[model samples]
Target: MSDRSYRFTHAITRKPAASIIAGLRAVDTGTPDLALMQAHHAAYIAALRATGATVIELDALDAYPDSVFVEDTALCLPSGAVTMRPGAPSRLGEAAEMAPHLEALYADVKRISGPDSFIEAGDILMTETEILVGRSARTNAAGIAELAALVAPWGETVREVHTPPGVLHFKTDCSLLDAETILATRRLSATGCFTGYRLIDVAEGEEAAANTIRFNDVVLMPAGFPRTRDALLAAGYDLREIGNSECAKLDGGMSCLSLRFTSKP
Candidate 1:
């Protein structure tokens, strides 16, 4: 196995109204108002680097305005990387843009074709024993089956989790905070979603704040969500709250800001 730590490379792009479902009618719809998005992406990249992980920055794909969020369309593992066929037609270009980077990162890079199969990176959560994939509109049954076959040889089990129909994606409602624990929203559990893993509840109205990224002992979370942040801090986690107001306006939170990976031992 490779000794090098997993590194992340991402492109920061301008947010478009089409990318954000809630802000489609706003005046700043198509403008190049990427300043805040860029800053948040940069901050996430910086935080990942602080974990002593190698960081690679890919050139922006001018064709796709939302290409900066590399996680939405691909899954990278030490053995190889899988390029997903985004369920959203508007985000299809992200898979094409991510292929070259994956090819360079690992000797074996595979792709899941659409028209029959569709998978989004946000639906995949990796743990030491298995790869939990969320089955949602963005990630279909075929996609999960294909992914399971692709990673089986690597000794990784692919478990399927049912997602709430109303949720936009899985990561937004549920995320793995560590190997043993998950920070999940009630919106997800109450809907009978997340079939396979253990669910740890966040307080009412604290669902959005449940989305967190674990970097070693430190957890990166959104600012202004003090209830959840304080809960995590009191639990012995070194919580780092970052401002993501602008990104939130575009339907983005901490997880949407960047794609993170760790090399296998």
Candidate 2:
């Protein structure tokens, strides 16, 4: 199994902008406080850096309120990086903005050029053995096909799957814990997409905790899901809980703030 899946040496994150109050959302629970979100973003970055990984912090793009969720902009693999074509019109340009940054770090950077292709890294989960893509409103079959074609030469396998209905992204309810273990929500696990992996279901009613990220030695999860947190702790993961209430107002969470990867210059 490739440790590249989770043992990353670098990560890229964008600061949350003041315009985050205008960020897209399925339902407006409340306005996101920029100052609070920024504080949370800093904590998130600190957690990533705590793993001894170099983090590239990018300036915020006020033009795109949702630009803070950099994971949706591209897919980073040990082989190369592929710029995504987001389905949301407002987020489409965010991918292009991330391409140059990726190109500077990866020798083999590619893009999903099909006009009809629409995919987001947030809909993708890279495991030790394969790439699992959950088709969502932001990710389509064409995007998946393009991504598959782009990475096939690198010997990576792509497995198409379905995101739970109503979820913003496939990863909204699941995350890879390690080579063989996954932390997921029962609603998503019930689909049988994770049949072969050792699965840890998030505590009932704490489904939001499913979007955690296992970065190197620490598993970064959002604060406030004690039941689920305790469960992960029991499983022996080094956990760090970051405040995500502000980002959560926009349906964003732990994994959405950054693009984690290890690349050869």
Candidate 3:
């Protein structure tokens, strides 16, 4: 399998706005500190830039409290990009806001215009061979089907899977560590959705660490998960731990902070 799936040349991130305190969450942990969240956001962008990739820093969209979780706006692929129709009522406008940005970067960009379809990149994991989309409260069958049809002509295959009950997004429980290896929570891996791939189970109770991203040579994960950190180290992954306390309150993780992709015009 090609490493292009995780190897990115460019990334796009939005600064966390003060309104992020109102960002949607399955449960309210606490109000996010804008200053602290900005600090963490800076560190994240730095880590991505350290890989020698160009990082497009977009201005904050305060009107949308959940805009910082940019991954839900679209799926960026080698062949093209697709703007999603977010299920959350407040998040719906976020997708349209992201479309022009994607158009500027991608030569061919598409949109999930089905009125009833709803998909988020947070619920979609792209592999070297196929795109695995987990059905979640934020992503539905119609959205998955639309995505499949849009990418079919590009030689991409979409496989629908089940996200564990109450999971906010598919990636809330798993992430691709490499072309053939996956870092997943036992809760997600146990579903047998990844039978063919190598698995690295996150340490018990450290399931939040599953929502990590393998970018270039480094794997970025939220800080505070010592056991999961040690396991990834043992596996020889170059890991960078970033403070995520603030974003965590809003159910945001490393993968949610940015959209990583390589596009050629």
lDDT of 2 by residue, 1-265 (tens): 3687899889999988888899999888999889988898999999999999999999999999999999999999887889999999999999999999999998899999999999998999999999999999989999999999999999999999999889999999999999999999999999999989999999999999999999999999999999999999999999999999999989998999999988665
At residue 39, what lDDT does model 2 achieve?
91
Clashing pairs in 3: none
CA lDDT of every candidate: 0.67, 0.93, 0.94
Per-residue accuracy of model 1 over 133-238 as CA lDDT, tens digit each? 8888788999999988888887668888877666666777776666566778887777664555566777788766766777665678888877777777776677
Model 1 whole-model lDDT (C-alpha atoms): 0.67
C-alpha TM-scores of all predictions = 0.83, 0.98, 0.99
Clashing pairs in 1: 6-263, 9-56
Q: Candidate 1 at 40: error in angstroms? A: 2.1
Worst 10 residues of 2 by lDDT: 1-10
lDDT of 3 by residue, 1-265 (tens): 3787799999999999888888998998888999999999999999999998999999999999999999999999988999999989999999999999999988899999998999999999998989999999999999999999999999999999999999999999999999999999999999999989999999999989999999999999999999999999999999999999999998889999999998664
